[model samples]
Target: MLSRRSVAVATMFLGIIYLAFISLGIPDSLLGSAWPVIRPDMGASFGFAGILSMVVAGGTIVSSLVSGSLVQRLGTGKITLISCCLTAGALLGFSMAPSIFWLVLLAIPLGLGGGAIDAALNHYVAENYKAHHMNWLHCFWGVGATLGPIIMSFYMVKHNSWRDGYTAVSMIQFTLAIVLLVTLPLWKRIAVSREHERLDSMIPQDQVGPELKQPAISSKANVLQIKGVKQTLIAFLFYCGVESTVGLWGTSYLVGARNMTAETAAGWISLYYGGITMGRLITGFITLKINNRVLIRCGQIIAIAGGGMLLLPLPQLFLVGLILIGLGLAPIYPGLLHETPTRFGRDNSAKLMGYQMAVAYTGTTFLPPLFGLLAAQTTIHAFPFIVIAFIILMMMSAEKVNHILNNQTKSTGINC
Candidate 1:
């Protein structure tokens, strides 16, 4: 059993990872705030800006896959440390880059580091921590996401340069990285013993002789079955699409379509994230009381309703629509994350998270660019329609997944 102190330390480690994710968002949020100014400064066309956004999304997809493999090889702790360092370096590079090309190149490391930290930390917490901890851990991410834009907006309004804003965020990230590095040894000592024992138990005892022999069960073979893994992966892929599309594009829609100022748009964006924060806290309280599949499906319906509201002609409904979307999305990611360990076993959670994250990042990569392209060609008023389509797809995919899980539960007598 994990000791209380060990669990607390692990949760803190996950919190550090959330800080890394927040650091990733600082660049994104700052870009949203600074784009109009920076675009003119850089002499770039709107098409170029759209392509640049795609480039960052593309890097995220690639890095998510690469980091997943790295985590599988090096363990989460080492990968997280390396990711944080790379992320900080990437931010510094962004601060100093002389050209758009250089900025795009810097995005590579930023994406890699951010993707790795997200996958590794998510897997670690979902597998090892209690369910409530998973919700709370992601809530920290919501806090960071909310703060990043507000901080950038403040600096922008103060007549400070974008470089200063970027640099400030980088310094904060570096501080978190340092804190994580200092605490890493303690986490490793607590975790490694359990990992080794699990590894040892996987070996064939007959080949190692009587001393190595232990209880005979088919747990390993059963765990290796890939059918359910494929189903879950499909569910996660669309879920990623729904989640990232809303998050990355919603601010732009508000700015471009609704004629809100950048500051106002960002403020409204904060409400979306704020709703997520509150929703996750509520999710933490209710998950033990409610069935997860039911909660997830209900969330999708709420998200669809939110998306539909965005499509309506009423201007007053926009904020309410976004809040509904946030509440709907809040439970899905963490719920899926929390379910992984039970489905695949704790030992496989890291690699599974890596794979799932890779798939999810593909959605993140594909959707934003598509939205950007569409927004570039047409009015941003069309944005809500795109979101609506994704939400409906999420609902359908989740239903399939729930059905699959239910059938599996019936067949195997397992709760997953």
Candidate 2:
């Protein structure tokens, strides 16, 4: 059993992790929410916003691909601290950006910083905490994502300046960076205590349960060679595609196709993210009763229905559909991530996490821009079709992963 001190330390560390996740999400929606005004101010085309988003996503892909090595060397705490600083500096740069060129350049560090913190915190939580904590951790991300548009809209409405919004968020990021610096040692303390607990829980091989008898997968083995790995990665890619496309273009779609004001569109988009926040908050409790697989399937179905709703002409349905998509997506990412150790192996989870993140960002990098091109050619009304297609692809890939994992478990006599 953990001593009271150890439990306190662990709780405190988790609280910090939650805050870090909030910081991680704070800047995500800023570009999207501000793009309507930003494009005109800079005399840029509507599709050009995708270029900036693509740059950010590209940088994220690079960082995520290398995050495993970085975490191994610098550890999660230092990585998170450094990432926070990088992101803060980038956001500050964003505030001063005079043109789309500068915004694209600033997006690079923004993406790099975000990917590192995301992978690091996700792996840490999945390794150390319960399924509920994973949900709640991501719930905090939703909080930040939800707050992001609200913050931007506030500044845009009150100050008529998106730069001021970026500046305000940058200040928040810098503050979190300082907090992370002070709490750096707590990570080690919690890690050591958890290690001690794990060691103490070890038992003789003869007494080990059947579930524990499976040999560890070698970390050196190519993770892509694993039976379900490719499918899981594909699922991740499409899942992120669906989410990022919406985030990057949802406001634009509202303004262009739906005839909504930029300020009103920003509010509606915030509601979409708010749905994610509220859904994840509720999902944390639901996880106590439902397994990850069930939650994931349910989320997908709801997302599909939400996408279908978007096809309707009624504005009321559009509002409901947006919220439904957010609620549907709330559980899927966290569920898949938390299940990594089980579907693969604990030894492989760390490396696989990085790969998964890289692929996810790859989707983020390319899909929205591709859609932007398509929208430029046709109309923003194409948005719902893209969202629906991505969700279907994600669902198929996820189910294939499940099938592959189940087969492997049956053949190898290892419980996943």
Which lDDT tens digits does candidate 1 get at residues 240-355? 77677777778888877787888888777778878888999899888777756667888888988888888766877877899999999888888888877665566566667777
Collision count for each candidate, in order? 0, 0
lDDT tens per residue, model 2, 1-416: 79998898899889989999987887987887899999999899998876887788888888988887788789889999999999999999989998888888888999999988898888888877778899999899877876898999999999999999999999999999999999999887787787788789877655765433434455655888877789999999999889888877999988998899999997887788778888888999999988888899999999999989988889999878999999999999999999887677877777788889999888877788799999999999999999999999999999998776666555665544
Question: Which segments of candidate 1 are over 4 A away from where they belong?
Answer: 1-18, 154-159, 192-225, 247-269, 311-319, 371-385, 413-416
Score candidate 1 by lDDT.
Answer: 0.72
Residue clash pairs of candidate 1: none
TM of each candidate vs. truth: 0.80, 0.86
